[model samples]
Target chain A: MTSIATAGASVTEQHAAIAGARPWQRLVLLAVGLLVALGLPWFVYPPVAMDIAAWALFAVALDLLLGYCGLLSFGHAAFWGGSAYATGLIAIHLGVPFPLAVLGGAVFAMILAVPIGYLSVKRSGIYFAMVTLAFAQMLFFIANQASSLTGGENGLQGVPRSFFGIEAVETDAFFFYYAALPIILLGMWAAWRIVHSPFGRVLVAIRDNAPRARALGYDVERYKLIVFVLSAGLSGLAGGVFAVSHGFVALPELHWTTSGEVVLMTVLGGIGTLWGGVIGAGLIVMLADYLASSGFDGIGIVTGGVFVTVVLLFRRGIWGTARHLWLNRKRS
Target chain B: MTSTTPTPRCALRTEGLTKDFRGFRAVSSVDLEVAEGTVHALVGPNGAGKTTLFNLLTGFLKPTSGRIMVFGDDVTGMAPERITHRGVARSFQITSLFENLTPREHVEIALQGLTNQGLRFWRSEKLLGRRRDEVDRLLAEVGLTELADKPTGLMAYGQKRALELALVLAVEPKLLLLDEPTAGMGIEDVDRTIELVRRIAEGRTVVFVDHNMHVVGQLADRVTVLQQGSVLAEGPYDEVRADPRVITAYLGEAHSA
Candidate 1:
């Protein structure tokens, strides 16, 4: 009994020590990451890189809600696709610059998110997810039926990228990549800051034991709503940027399948770790791209198999599992 | 009996407090008053509505057709957090802690609320280093300084109880509702906890429910015994213990043991 007790104590100490990354290590990793992100398009197709960055931002936004806040939203496509359509519409009709249009789209998506999030957060677990999914379906229906605004099935096309009042990025993928990279990085930084802040600590507490947090004088629902809105705004930012980068907003952007895809990305990369979402997004996007290029008709089977293996063997997702193993190895 | 004519300083009071689940009344109309700076123990047999009354007082459950007044302020139907904000904190009968968090993290989270920094998202948590001395003092008080960095899940049960008490004290609450604070503990742990409670209740008003009669007999300044869903007897521990209804409530279990 004494030996068992000692073992438990040591394991807990090691776990606590490994829970957070050291500041200098995080800084070094961030620097290396930024350099790789800046040079990534030079090696791969710039458009694909841009896609990865946008989806990475979206996944990070979802992670803020799903991972940190313990909220599983199944209708994030509303923010993504809704903002994409809004950004495309503004660019096509109002002749606004890309930055303003993306901002406008993001703001519009946040406006939509307020009511949806307010209602959805009132429920929890599968009910919360279903409510979000229901709201997204509603938005999808609106986008499809409003053919004059959204272009129906054909989607909103001919979205000109007016870069800083100059149409320099209209046809240049590299210019678009440079422009989108900073926004994605900023979003990533925001998520990291939130997770490290006092507010973030409360979020984790709520995630762990909400009733206890409430008893400790935290307005748990208010915190959940704040995170939900923040996640939606970030997601909208990604969608708006994606619309500008691609110069089009398709109906599929708002589809439930799109929401599922991002969820898959977050889970596959790792859930709670902020960078896990980015890695998951990159992996899924790359896998789908490769499958499409190789004429693999059964991409779903392969992806499903990968997901099953990850769930069974590495439940913490790729990054979390890796960190856990590395920490245990170091301890031993 | 001659009653004193002094104005009673009640820290917490319930007026016709009742709770109904569907149609079944778990706690019938119950009026309770806990005076300021006293450790009041509510004792009852299993399912005698002790936990439910504790929940009603702490704002975990809304009272049906009643008012909960804390220091003369009617705070009925308020959210649990709001009640906590108004200087009430509680612990569960079962250990309810963030299993993944270290004892230090649990205290820090509670301190975040107490220090009014719970909403500060942009600042680094290390800014709370200013209060490191206070956190250390609290941990030391509970004799948990050695296990401060350990995750709560890995701590021995007695350590978790101490940690929970430290967390409850972190709120600097005027009223504390501790549900079975020393429910399942060894004799050493129970004695230590009784001492800890006695020390902490120096200025604060505490309402606790416990199954351990010895701890209650030692710590409670006054005792209220519940039968079914109503208070059957109220007096000093010895006086309430001798009450026929109170004894009958625990007759089979006490005699068997």
Candidate 2:
């Protein structure tokens, strides 16, 4: 995002650099990660890769605000879950094209978040986190209570996977994986661009020291709002993908636990580092899947335990640790 | 120096600016009119509300009871960014800059304000243009061009101060406010800072709050001495230096410190 092409760092250069790096080189490690992500499904099942991709994109959205902007939202479930049900409803009720419906659902999520984010951004620290959580919980209850519109706890089912005219998006495990891969990749690419831009530099400035950013003549509120909307919109994209992949959308999609899970993914991947979010999401989701099949009666307890341990011992997360190691290696 | 003492439509004028914190006056009943193109100095001892006055003047502190006029517009309690947009950019006493960013990056972000590129991350020209030229020139002006690509956190104290000055000047404001631009610098850096400030004030209007009498004397065309939230004395640096009340009230505190 911060790279000037005239100065250099166009989206093409970024992609090319990723491609051009000598495989194990530093400049394209993230590119390597994405390549592995594309191929990782071969080793694992397609559904598993698709699930990780969706959650990874969602977690990246969270990382954008929480990690980069220094704003930790406890209500991202509003984007994730709300978009899921909304996409489901539009697909089932309006009979709209899947791609268009998902876009509409994303727009819906962005709009819904305006007031909540507006008011919440007025506060800082735990208050900001709590306000977002409260809004998310409110969304959860609304989803549950509006059973007629939402199909209650059972959620809306039988969502058409055929997004737009593309019949390739049906609920087949492999097809769904391929269908979601591009969107997820695009989301990650866009996010990576945003964070690397000069505009992205200002967000970090706002996070690191807001008073200074303001003193430098930045309308901090405007920057925060724009990114908030963008993050929510991308998260909404992930939600849309989720609904399409499963052929169902339920009220639990908006639940606070879902919100918490995204937050965990962001933090566990090392909040503020873009690639960390994806790594964290994949690790956690893969762990959850493993534990679920292994008859681990309480996945949350184990997940929670690991989360605490990571927070205590390795606060930077796996990706952050890698970056740290790389920086050190170069310096020495 | 050109003693024109620019009076360009009263670029930054405050009428009856007052601020109270918890029933105590931090800055009270103060009126200041800085001409459009001369360097004005606001000098006083520590704990005499110099920073508080700076905060109020820069819109960081809301006046309990007064109007702050910038470039002849009444912007009494407007937020800092609005005031800054209206051409009243300032530098912090502590050199508030993006630590992880290079001086080039910091200056570019500041330039984004002038170019109207807020929140449009993907369309930034930060690494090029008159923007970089301006940053480089300003860095050169403040003797920091050699370190333009260095991260701010890694710069020497003097270089950081110089970078902050470059950033403040980046907006090309009608008035520039410096809050202790020379604080905590070694004698050589302080001398260099005064030289840079004096060079820039030749064409720009400035009102800085500082404690160093030497810096104040070397740069100020006119001086305003503040003590306990009110003006103790206002005149040429020589006159303010002679005033007994100014000494007993503001300078006396510096003596104690």
Native-to-model Cα distance after best TM-score fit, residue A222 in candidate 2, in Å = 0.6
Return the clash pairs for model 1, or none.
none
True contacts kept of each: 0.69, 0.52
lDDT for each residue of candidate 1 in B1-257, tens digit (9 for 90 to 100): 13242667789878888889898788887788888999999988888899998888878888877888898788898989999998999999999998657888888888777555867777886766668887898999999999887667778999999999999999999998999999999999999999999999988999999999998999998998887778788988889988887777798656765
Give the TM-score (0 to 1) of chain B in model 2. Answer: 0.92
Off by over 4 Å in 2: A1-31, A163-168, B1-8, B124-130
The per-model DockQ list reads 0.63, 0.44
Please list all clashing residue pairs in model 2, or write none if there are none: A1-A196, A1-A197, A2-A196, A2-A197, A2-A198, A4-A8, A5-A8, A81-A253
- Model 2 scores a TM of 0.92
The local distance difference test score of each candidate is 0.84, 0.79
- Our model 1 lands, by Cα RMSD against the true structure, at 4.2
Off by over 4 Å in 1: A1-20, A165-168, B1-6, B114-116, B255-257
Each candidate: chain B TM-score = 0.94, 0.92
